[model samples]
Target: MPDADSNPGNGDGREADVVPGNQGGRASRAAALSVRSLAVRSLAVRSLATLRAAVDRIIPADSWPAGWEGGVAEYLTVDPISADRDLAWAWPELISLAGRLDDEAHRAGADGFASLDPAAQDRILAVVAAGSGARSFDALRRVCWEGYYASSEGRHPAGLDMVGFRGVPEGVTPIEPEPLKTVAPAVVQAHYDAVIVGSGPGGGVAAQVLTAAGKHVLVVERAPYLRNDQIRGDHLHGKRNAVYWPTVGPGPGHPRVAQLPDGDRVLDGTDDASVYGLNADAVGGGTRIWQGMAWRFMPEDFSMRTLYGNPDGASLADWPVSYEEMEPYYTKAEWQLGVAGEEGGLTRRMPRSAGYPMPAMGTEPSRELLGAAADRLGWGWGPIPLAINSVPWDGRAACVRCAQCIGNTCPVNAKNGSQSTFLPRAIATGLCDLLPDAEVIEVRDGTGSAGVTIMADASTSPVELTVSADVVVVSAGAVETARLLLASGLGNDHVGRYLHDHRTATVLGESEHPVKPYIGPGHSVATLDHVHADTIPWGGGVIVDLMGLLPLTSAGQPAPGVPGWGAGHKEWMRGERANLFGVFAMGQEIPLPTSRVTLAAVKDRWGRPGAALRKDVHWTSQQVEDGMAVQGARWLDAAGITDIRRQGGPATASAAGEHSCGTARMGTSPENSATDPFGRVWGTSRVVACDSSLHPTNGSVNPTLTIVANAFRVAEHLVAEWPR
Candidate 1:
């Protein structure tokens, strides 16, 4: 019935199947598989069939009273995790495993695995689960749970009533993600007074300060500000859907060669399938997404080498600027950004200049439990400072106390992200050009003649432009910022050296009474009791009482070695969702030269160099995290938590968190660091490093406040020194 022009097909009177299938019933089989995207390849049917036979052993339906109807293999066939390279690479092996198991069952007097009794199937699975087959088994299990428990069927009346999960409230109407191309045009000018590479907390603050000082600042951001429309409280996209990270990006597929014991494994940011490093790409950087834990480093954090002395295999050094000088800017950030907290309990290394602009956010049941536990154990505990409006500051609405806040856009415009704060203010000043989807490939001429080569988002029409500026401020984040500098051959040898991030550990506690961690802000309580080493190792950090994870993350992780699908994990969440609490260690890591960020062999999406990050965490840093994890477990026990599960310690594998920093490190001289005391690149007069990269070492607390404060400090210094 179709026109020949519109419906071009073979003249054989048959339609061609885009899905290349292997058998004569290929068309029929492929159609069935297409519904669940199991038609990714010709062997998809065989792969999925093999998978179903194998998955039954790990997550058996007969094991539960009202069990999941063996749809786990279907979920595994379509879940995002299943699409990734880690699983895809092992998928063939898994298929082989299924065949081998079936063959074994045949040899053992049974027809096959599916025909064998449950006992026999599990016995065969046990060998695979214990040995190298554990890799494929764990991968299959993770996706199975993610798909099953993250579905409406899994969180049914039977389960939801048990867990008391109201689910993420759907009051705020969701909108489509907005790219601010109309309001903020992509018109690249010939020149400007200054150019900032990123639009994060640091870059946003710097833009506000510099533009207010009457400097024409051009802010280049690789990602568009998706705005409030992107917030849907969908745990699938916002939370543990990516396991260790949120579903954000480095934009245009910046690949990295992460050092592994076996060999170098290449990670392409553009290719979601092979994600090794995760960083959000947007106008406001991480501030648009972070939960906002605002805290200043203790005095000892600055002078780590001065106080503890640099240990073996560590690159510890004193910051050129002191906490005393940074205190004014810290106060400025707190007041200007509307941070809320009281200035008492667990005495700090130094006193605050003034109390936080607003009072602390309301507490949850976990806070009470933690305080009581701390009191009983004679350990220090207190409320954490938050960057949300307690009583509606700066015309932003007050927080509605949303449960899912971390790594998500604020549902009610209550959160204080840079996109809502400094960038807006900077734009209002009419002196800053906030250009989103502008990826800076490199930074050159660090002195009076500075310039950057930028390309529009690859998804759009390619518009490569070279914008020159009098000054260059690279705050593209620790990794990308360092990569740009290294690519341009700017600054000293330390340009890409000393990459670091907080070594974290977490303890999930199951309380006797319902604590209901989903009632308040995601991060409401923390204690600075252990700012420095009192009894632990050389490094010290704060232990915070974090909110319970969303159901998606919770389902995947119940206890170590526990099958994520079927009975154990789902049953645990049903009984304990309300009573779950976590103790998180946001601790420090000494800068190590070996843990450096360099240019990777593989090019980015724009044909530019990618980052080759070598993260060599010292054994002592692991010791600090291990010690904190041990103490956190003890605290949970003291609070009368019946069951506690600890993750991350000395034995845990090293992976980068959202807080990775300190590649283009700042110091006094070119010999040691990339930037000077005022954050100006040592070899250049005006070009500077303004983000957490300016930090000589990552302090125990979250670095957003410090990054912004330093940005303000550098802006002030530039305002005074530069010819305005």
Candidate 2:
């Protein structure tokens, strides 16, 4: 290990007091603002005192492998009161709640939580952790473990030697924050051919294709260009870092209010438990962080209402464009992005026009292990189709086989996100100018063109900037794109309507040796047997294998009935290390009219209304999701993996806060849809949306590739329509 000064906890000269923050996927990145650092802020004394006194009890030191490590509970304290507070402040609130509960307890005679004796504190905390104060307590305990378990103190704990759980966050490659490539407002000579908002899959491809067609393209992205240092794969940073760029991003100040059955509630962007509607914002967008599984929707996906016959209460409709028209673009995206894997014919899957640019990655023990279970159950499982490179294709390097694939930025630069795949080419063409951190607040109709008003690099310096374009393509995912269109007063009738996502059911289990889940990419193998099967009563889901969990993430999540802290929790962590497996069912939900995104009444920091996401997934979709759960549980049972429990409840839209679509949907008319078949806003030829919002239904597949393909298709129209 490093010198004695590095570790200060153990008596024999280990790291001292567990480093304030964690050494997650980003070990080399400079540490900043530990929970201890929060103590220096306002009300810091009471928060720190309350946290220090309670962390050991919430996560007892003796109960853990180490004798005592004191930094974790402190990691739970942050002061967001000074912040704009639109971000996830579960930590600050949890710490503040600790102070609140302590005050209440103090009034009842015990001084405070910190001053109370161990037994009394435990009694109060247990009730709070399991009762009305549960949200805060549970959040506190989780972050406490997120900091502790990922630390040097928690990594080399007593019994961990047998489990061989060293905690994730292995290597560290330092990188500067990606500088904002700003577009000088004075440089534009005239109205550009196109302006694309949101540098995600849809916009990235559209910009590339349009620029290649010799059109001047100005691409405005809302998030800063995050350098490698900014994106660490650590559970603390990648999984639990809600303060900034949580998988759902623009970290703070981007509020997405939800209209619920009870009433409209403004969502804390950071809290995973509460926020149902989710959208990702970034220079690279969802492609930057998504688990790179690029499956194509079946031909039936284009005509869901026709094929399935629209169920009552669900606002399903036929796409104006058919699968045949989209086929060439799909072929182009796969080849251009250098997708891997082979011909897919898994159960109810669709036929493809061509094979992948490269063959699937060489087989590992996971396929065979999961395949054996599939064989026993008569299910068809195979190597999952992936955008990740098996061997170096194009100029990018091959995947380094780092298990920390999803959510974490690729240190080796192998994962083919649209940001890396298309934006580079678009920029290289010299005709495309990308302005990162430019939040497009409004897109209005200019004289024979479209006008976009934005705050250039809104993160650091917010300066109002407006630019005119011949065409405007808003691709800020489903929610944000809809918000922009509504704010711009285009597509006001249908904008921000029909929101949906792959209502998923996570089935976590433990395998023996054949499946070393913490090895390769996040998702490598999957079964498509359940999807759209006649045998199944409802629409089915895809079951893909995952790269399990880090010790920090897994430690916080005890088995179904086990207590989250103490000896039982520690022992449970040991048995679950390599044995753990992630087999999840991504079920399709019926998109309802009520499940929509509207402009919130309150304005955000940008002076535009925040996105108001309202979800009411149909009951039949709930049935399908429930059916998928049982089907996935059976798959795990057949594999002899134990501790199989369904992660989420019935009919709930989404938990991971992503893969949402259908809002601002495409169709034949203005009343029912926001955009035309070519992604053109109804009644407006030049204005369009190129994101998942154009999708009328999110088929039983990931939508990134499809979004890219559809964008390619739309860009062709924009090219042909432009004055050559």
Candidate 3:
């Protein structure tokens, strides 16, 4: 048997206890043994009974197997959630909730919650929802759904069938021909021409550029290299699932302190989406599991300050490089990464030198409905540019249009990320070595002796090593890159300032037609009309026809005041949830100097100070979101979709940090920015930042394409300036 350290499912590295036909008898026997052994290590009898009852109530057996019978209870008792390291703080509350359920049941004159009639149990649950136990109730409902929806690998297979979800396309699996070649810590060289601190879009592009130039490169990534098999498309537990914790992460030992106005709360990367600001930490970083929307910034986006002056307390600045300058690089990135999209009909006008390498993905049904609505509204709309293959491109297969995308890895190796493209190309040259599961704690800055202090196997038995490099590039995302510079005692006072991200609002409505949303990438057509609408406050954003409505994602918005559990909620899931469509608007937030990352007093397992965040999204960003929400609702109404509901906006400012950037912003001077125009850290010539951290202002669209383009530009510049 494999050791627990090697496991992805339950920590024993064994295949999970899936249902018949999915696994062999040995795995089935192990699951059976695990279920039987729960009495010793699982919840007490009363608590287990209460939990089982709760699960049944959340997802009742109307036309399908109930949550209680469909492996939910067993899933809760086993490896992933039960002994999850990151979710350790949540278990006590779950235990308490079980005990509280019985107390409530007794008040209602029942022997126990599980012993009460279904209707009676629901009445008590309603009382709990209205009372202080509301939070606990929500938690229970969430865990129940996660257990049911995320564990459908044979364990609740019927639930997926009922929802019209076809599993991974036939014969689809992880596409890497052999295991990814990685350099063991013992074999790593003490010196390199270039050492990149991340393996994300930026770092990957940099590696490809430098290695192709015959420069020896070391790519250090803190997270483990997640094989496709390891990234099981668990709806609630995968890398993209922000409901609890992202599977790929800043991990257990590396916690951040959110300095909220209420108080300083220590947070895991998954604690609060708005405040924690988590990007993936693995080999491809966010690219491995991203939705692959490759959007180009409008020309005006580069001149944010020139278009609309800064809002009060905002650090809005124009990028040192313009779209005209970056256009060639953008084209290069699009072609290299294999984007699929149609040209023209952009909402906000952007002059493109060339079209996408591949044609747009076949329009999803939701986009057709919304595109007609946009035509009626006289808004320019076109297919969303995506870094995913339409046909077999660059040796990768085309997307199978699986219901699961965004958070899940591409089973067919169609989703083009740094993992699939740049990194592999760099590795093929044998000039670039990737060091996964290694954390660069600090960069030693000097005139000619640039190097980094690395912690190998950071999550386990860590060993410190010092390695020298002629050039050092940091691409560890916005917050992490800023934190790294601060931790390394590098950069100026502006090192972690001007932090911001895209604030978004999603307007959901019941489509008049059956726009099968659970197919393909979440969004298809996006309009640029909102990108620079004068009617919008501060600035405008883009609106996309969004899809991918999983059971848990649907549960996030219950029908207004209706109880989260019981027959009414279940009915909502079956009817309204099934016919749902979404219009999502993402707005670029105003960067505030006050919104910064600093070194916190709290230390990690490695005894390093944690990143402290004081995230402040300006009111204008909220107004931008609100304006977009109004437009989205208008579009939905025009599309004849009724029962409109708005889920996000500036009100969700705390969680508005997704697509986060602009921490170590770029500028002309060291006094105002962490890095110069060429991505060189102001104070140090050898150290450079190659990620979105150098973004002076974030665009209204996704940043991956731009990050890749900019990294390519910067890497090319570095090679030209190399001491040849």
The best candidate by TM-score is 3
Return whichever of 2 and 3 wins on TM-score: 3
In model 2, what lDDT does residue 354 have? 78
Quote each prediction's TM-score: 0.84, 0.82, 0.89
Cα error, residue 308 of model 1, in Å, equals: 1.5
Which residue pairs does candidate 1 place in steric collision? 253-270
lDDT tens string, model 3, 455-518? 9876556788899999999999888898899998988999989877777787877776678656
**Candidate 1: global Cα-lDDT?**
0.66
Across 581-676, the per-residue lDDT of candidate 1 in tens digits comes to: 767776778789988888778886777787776778787787787778877788789889866877533433233445777777778778888888
RMSD of each: 8.8, 7.8, 6.3
Evaluate all candidate structures by whole-model CA lDDT and list the values in order.
Answer: 0.66, 0.66, 0.74
Q: Judging by lDDT against the true structure, name the best candidate.
A: 3
Error of 1 at 602 (Å): 2.4
Q: Which stretches of candidate 2 lie over 4 Å from their true place?
A: 1-140, 150-190, 237-248, 268-277, 344-349, 510-516
Worst 10 residues of 1 by lDDT: 1-10
Off by over 4 Å in 1: 1-139, 151-167, 170-186, 231-246, 270-275, 346-348, 446-448, 560-565, 576-580, 642-645, 651-656
The TM-score, computed over Cα atoms with residue i paired to residue i, of candidate 2 is 0.82
For model 3, the stretches where C-alpha displacement exceeds 4 angstroms are 1-54, 78-117, 127-139, 152-158, 170-177, 269-274, 561-563, 654-658
